[model samples]
Target: MKARLMWIAGSLIVIALLGYGGLSYALRQNPHAVLDTVDRIAGPSGSVEQVAEASTGPHRQQRLLVYRSDDAAEALPVLVFFHGGSWAHGDPQHYGFVARSFAEEGFVVVLGGYRLGDEGRYPAMLEDTAAVVGWVHANIAKYGGDPERIFLGGHSAGAYNVAQVALERHWLEEEGVPESALRGVIGLAGPYDFYPYDSASTKAAFGSAGAGAESQPVNHARAGAPPMLLVHGEADTLVKPRNSRALAKALNEAGGRADTLFLPEGDHNAPLLSLANPWRRDPLVHDRILAFMREAAKVSVPVQPQTP
Candidate 1:
């Protein structure tokens, strides 16, 4: 009886905290464990499988987590996501909520993690992103995904990671992944035009690359690039909304399809936080992304998830 009462009390505490929007702080303090617990408490989302490495090469060293709804289609559309931690601190294991949210929505979600901090410098991170795409292009079919219907997405620095891969052809070409394979790209609160790095996270990850156009995704925007959705918050002082605005402007001017969204009340973390189940306040972000992916991929409609 005592243990049962304690269990009830603990559950109530968690419920209260989540109800009151304490998840953001919980994620900041311990993202991996928090999301893991959230995933479990949320009940069965889908089946998840992890690959140790995408490939055997040095650049192919990143890990991937694949999530599929219990009733996913034979060839479900794929969404590969990378987390944000100033490009220094993040792990694939931390985004189960993200994976579950999309997987539950009837998509095959891939949560990817690359090397971080000093070891993950500029080109290394880009290389890993491309490598992960290449691996998914080659192997996702075996995991019940359509290799041709791949969409790339990320938050913050991870957003830059996907943006670079989608905008720049060389990275994917080097990995034998044709740029056309990507159905669309989504970047939330990404820094695309920042050249003169001032933040410690930017400096730590990009210092070696120098303040050159070569490392900026905005510079790579051109005609024939894959469709993109860049969402940022006007209130975001961390990365700034101009990055997305500039990139979208450049892409559209160059004859590419890039959409931009700026939320007035949104901060740096709002876009990402909206992806979690509990804090999913606004439906526009999810709706727009889904519409972009569906339209770009030309899917007839959303596939209904089967019972797990």
Candidate 2:
């Protein structure tokens, strides 16, 4: 009987090892699908609930999900992270691992889906970003999150969306939401200065929408903007590391609090991968983001009481 039990334990260990090897090999080629499967197999690290219905038409992100652990006794900081698919693809449902990871770390994490594809277009993407921010500020407390302690972040095209929505006042204004609601912003391997619309994804998302206009986030740097942590990989060729440097430089020149973290040999997906479980090759990226969020959360945005 003891020998049989030992055999069973040994078999389990070998299976776990094989699964790990297969997952690591597949992650290089298909990160999103692998993450989605991981979430499915292990289940989310915390409780997850859908808070809104998906919008009809190009508004993929009209719907969103919230993740939280059950032991919270007080309001925690909020983190709203969007996925990147060149503004043309990606679903937040597939990225539950991201939401759950931060949720486990004591944040009421929000993973929102935004509109994608040509039908969604340029302004529509930014518009959904504003809507999601507005929604979080207005209704996060019911889920044990402090609305004032809101941190916005994303990867790739999703990073572009949050940067523009936080930097450009007009989008939030159009939604009747105050920009001060945002405490800090985080972007990973984002494109802030790709102006020519040369890439297929950019051309499809913004070509006819407004190709020649100054829609780049680097163009909107100004004083009094929320604190920003722009993280990138020095070896990133997809969006170019210079995009992050240029925007950070612009923000610094404008007297805003903008800092950067560039991995010497990092690639485009490396920053995001650091936030994942069992595969975090770059923990500094994750640690730096948490530090920024904790510091920024202490300073509340001043807002006047609403008049009756």
Candidate 3:
């Protein structure tokens, strides 16, 4: 009996180690490749039009991909999404699955590419984001998007960029755009309050900016900022959920409208990856996003279930 109990315990230990190893390996894989695989499996659900030369960056000109519903005719709400890759990787191409999911739900989605970590840092990413937003504002009407109902969102590092651009005001001000132009901002598993450059990636991206607080979105939270929807998964181990909680708290204290959605079962990547077909589960991330946009834009469009 003692021998049998020992074997069982040993087997359980091995299984746990193997599971941990697999998850670690998955998390370490190239984010771009991971997103590409997801996109391929899910496939695009909307029509894609590429703006090969939408905005110019310090290194090279960037492109913007617009996702529009096949039957979209009238001006629709716009969602400009920024992809997260630790501020170093990821592209709009890898996010077609997400963009299309939004497009299918009656939104004209814009995915913009920006300079990454080694390519650029801090304000450069912010600059590119602002330029992209300006480009969308100026050109989205051609794609049947209402400029007045433009919303911005992103996951992880991208979310930080979105929050910075929307709240800091200077980035948009430099682009000759007003804060009021944005209807709302959304952040998913964003590191809005991470500071002191604990990680190499964070240091590489934001270390040079003296007084790290300036780079933190929580530091900039105040009244009159666009309404924000901050979402986080309770189980996220990458970026802590407290980042969202802290930012939301600050926003509310300042009399700003910042709503938070805490997913009891969500993880760091769940908010983004759950958009994929077959991988999608109940309480779809896309639905919550659309609902937030509808309420903020005050547009009463019926939500259409995404076809898997």
Candidate 4:
């Protein structure tokens, strides 16, 4: 009877594993299908040019997608993007809508892929991000993107990366990139702090050394860092809203231009993923982000905020 009970338990474990695997597969596929449906119905007809090239190092060759409203290759504002996957599993392709939206809005958009957690950690991720930004500054004008108006933005872990590369000037300085080279930073549900590793989820990402307040973005706030815009949902279960709020407070305390958007009853995935949809748009989120970008760029154009 004991042996039979053990066998039953083993069978249940196998079934549970299969069920979880199937659910994960569906979650991954569903997002893509939603993106596809949106694209088919509302994709822009403009012919965007793409150039795939290797970076300075052997890390990985990146695909640079350049969408221009005009044929003349002139200097235009640029938006450099990093994707998020908890430092595990995300690619540039997953953020097609995010990049395309900014590109279509008359900014040259760069969506870059970096090495994941399976690779080295800490400085490695920051190094890759800096390399990509440098590459864009050097090659963006060829695609009609202005090298002068380069902004860094990302979602989730990508957001954390953006904050790191922007806040920690040492990385860019190492690459000979002047602090002024960056126009601004936009982060969506990013993990800005690394300390106190209070929660198991955060600790898992940052490790034990980050438990101190000094390890958090709050610890690195300074006036020299570029202006920042932080966005997060009030109902975010994965990353709390305090992440953005704390970062904003630090930036402001440091006399830096900082703003934040807190989505009402929105979760982490819904807020970022809804960037592809107009109907599900959060006026506070989209308009505030655009405002931050414009203010950072010093552009005088007024942006009409989308209705919630």
- The number of the candidate with the highest TM-score is 1
Error of 2 at 126 (Å): 0.7
Model 4 agreement with the true structure over 1-308: per-residue lDDT tens digits? 65345445544643564577853565566654445335323443444434444455665533334445555346768888887777766667656676556655667778877776645255556778888888887877787777778889888888888888888778777766677768888888888865656665455455632335544567788876787777888888788888888888888778676666677877887557666643224345555666677676774232322222
Ranking by TM-score: 1, 2, 3, 4
- Misplaced by over 4 Å in model 4 are 1-26, 29-37, 47-56, 61-67, 70-73, 198-205, 208-215, 278-284, 299-308
Say which candidate scores most in lDDT: 1
Local distance difference test scores for all models:
0.77, 0.77, 0.77, 0.67
Scored by Cα lDDT, where does model 4 land?
0.67
Model 3 agreement with the true structure over 6-118: per-residue lDDT tens digits? 44554454356457785246447755455445444444333544433354555552667888876777799999998888888877777776776677778888987788866
What is the lDDT, from 0 to 100, of the residue 94 in candidate 1? 79
Candidate 4 or 3, higher TM-score = 3
The alpha-carbon deviation from the true structure for residue 101 of candidate 2, after best TM-score superposition, in angstroms, is 1.9
Model 2 misplacement above 4 A: 1-30, 39-61, 300-308
Model 3 RMSD in angstroms: 9.4
lDDT tens digits, residue span 1-308, model 2:
65345445544643584677975676666677676555434432344444443342344456678778777546999999989988877888777767766776778888877778865688888878888877777788888888777889999999999999889888877766676667988999999998888988888888878655468999999988887899999899998989988888888888786788888888998888777644443468778888778877887542221110
Instruction: List the lowest-lDDT window of 10 residues for candidate 2.
Output: 299-308
Candidate 1 stretches greater than 4 Å from native: 1-15, 18-25, 32-36, 39-61, 299-308
Question: What TM-score does each of the candidates earn?
Answer: 0.85, 0.84, 0.82, 0.79
